[model samples]
Target: MALTGAGMSTASGIPDYRGPTGSQRKGSPMRYEEFLHDPEGRRRYWARSYVGWWQIATARPNAAHAAVADLQRSGAVGAVVTQNVDGLHQAAGSGRVLELHGTLARVVCLDCGAVVPRVQMDRRLRSANPGFAEAAESVADELRVNPDGDVDLPEDLVASFVVVPCPVCEVGTLKPDVVYFGEPVPKDRVERAYDLLELAPALLVLGSSLTVMSGYRFVRAAVRRGQPVAVVTDGATRADGDPVLKVAAPVQELLPQLVSDLASQPDDDSAEPAEALAASR
Candidate 1:
């Protein structure tokens, strides 16, 4: 099983939270509690998201994503579990992928349990607020786009911005389907990831700091089960000292080479499992 994170999509124009060139802007991200209770916070979130959504929506799969797909197709990998919500793994042709965090491509109505495509929400927001996108863009010159499709904006502008409610249930609040900080990942998603990890002989970690417990728990579980763990990322991670093989390199440059090397090796029916192979290295 392969576990991926934000760094996997950095080449595709997404920013990571704690990479070498960490988050470009500084501010607290919207918390689940604030979003649920504070109308003003929700308004600010949607206001920034209205303009920033285009960046994530238009992004394409990069080399790292394609290499993972190649590994899966070559029968080198069985399942993919990613902490990223960008849907790049699916976009790159990887199957049996588990999105640890819910995707930003969808929105849910808080009051009515109605799920809607983000594109439709974008269209509705655009129609409701003419020239708003242009205005936000002009002021966002100094702001860095976040992975969650949010950008730093002046407080005054945020106050002036308009937020659209769910179209299906007029009174319900609409929010992206992502797992927010202070919110738990869905129980079923966690169970599915654990099941995949239990079946795999090894776990390959890519582009994650594993700072959050949500992503770190899998690493701990794999270690407890005696699964060989390989980490391919550019910087320090919580699992740095634990992996059997740790490579400090960018995934975009490393994954393609790794995939090629694996493809060139002659197939050996009696070859050792991935855990043994990694442990030997």
Candidate 2:
């Protein structure tokens, strides 16, 4: 099984939280409790997301994503579990991807539980706030967008921004379908990931720091089960000492070569994992 994180999509221009450059935005991300309890927080989230959503919605899959898909096609990788919500792995043609966090491509009504495509919500926001996008673009030249489509904007701008309710429910708050800080990953998702991990001979981690337990717990589980683990990332990770093989390199530069080397080897499985890991190094 393969596990990926925000760094997996960084090559496509989305920034990861707690990376070398740190968070791109000024304030902390919206916590689930805050988002649910505070009307002002919800308004602020939707306002920034209204403008920043375009960045995530438009991002394309990079070489790392393609390489993973190729590895899967070659039977070197069986399943993928990702902490990222960007849907880039699916865009790259990977079939059995499990999104640990929910996707940004969807929005769900807090009250009604009705789900809608993010593009449709974008249209609704645009229709409700006339000229808002144009005005925001002009002033947001210095703002940085995150993978979850959050951006830093002035308080005054956020105040001026308008938020729309769910069209179906009419009373519920609408939020991107992602697991926020202070929110729990649904039980079923966790179970499904564990099931995949059980079947995998080894765990291959790509482009993740595993700083949050949400993504890190799986690594811990794998290690406890005596599964051989390999990690490919550019910087320090929580699982640094746990992996049987740890390679510090950019995924975009490393994955294609690993895929090529694996493809060239014999169809036999015995020598493949070690040979591929050594060749990648």
Candidate 3:
């Protein structure tokens, strides 16, 4: 099984929260509480998201994503569990993928619980705030998009942006389907992840620092179960001090090599797991 994080999509132009240089550059992501009760905060979020959506929307699956899909098809990887809200895994042709957090392809009404495609909301946002995207582009050098598909902007710029109500209820605010910081992943999602983990012989962690419990808990669970854990990333991870086989490298370059090495190995069920791909790292 494979577990991926924001780092998996960073090669495709998305930013990660905590990877190489992450300690120095990572910004605080939006929290669920502020988005739920603070109208201004929510407005700011939507405004930034409206501008930053292009980065996430236009991003293509990178080499790492393609390698994972290749391995999955070759029977080297069985399942994938990712913390990314970006749908790159599915975009790369991977099957049996589970998005630990929700996806950005959808939007949900806070009051009515009505769900709609993100493109639907995008069209509405475009209609309500004409030239807003172009205005943001005009000051492109000033904007820094984050992993949550938002960027910090000048208050004056955000103040002029218009927000629309949900079409179904005509009163509820709409929010991205992604799970925000301080928000819990739905119960069933966690259960399904654990179930998949229990059945896999090993957990191959790619591009994640495992900084937060949201993704780190799976590492702990794998460790407690005596499952061998292999970590591939460009920086020190929370799992470094643990018993995991740590290999600090970029997943974009290394994952494809891993698939090639596995394909070259003799087809022996008795082959050792550690010897299967660790040499490639």
Order by TM-score, highest first: 3, 2, 1
Weakest lDDT window of 10 consecutive positions for candidate 1 = 272-281
Local lDDT at 261 for model 3: 77
Question: What is the Cα-based TM-score of model 3?
Answer: 0.95
Q: Compared with the true structure, what per-residue lDDT tens digits does model 3 show for residues 1-281?
A: 89998889988989887758547365687899999989898889999999888789888999999999998998878999999988999999999999999999999998999999999998999999998888887876767778899887778889999989999999988999989989999999999999999999999999998887888988999999999999989987888889999988899998898877777767775345456567876
lDDT of all predictions: 0.85, 0.87, 0.88
Give the CA lDDT, 0 to 100, for residue 208 in model 2: 89
- What is the Cα-based TM-score of model 1? 0.93
Candidate 3: 10-residue stretch with minimal lDDT: 268-277
Better of 1 and 3 by TM-score: 3
Flag clash pairs in model 1: none
lDDT of 3: 0.88
lDDT for model 2 comes to 0.87
Candidate achieving the largest lDDT: 3
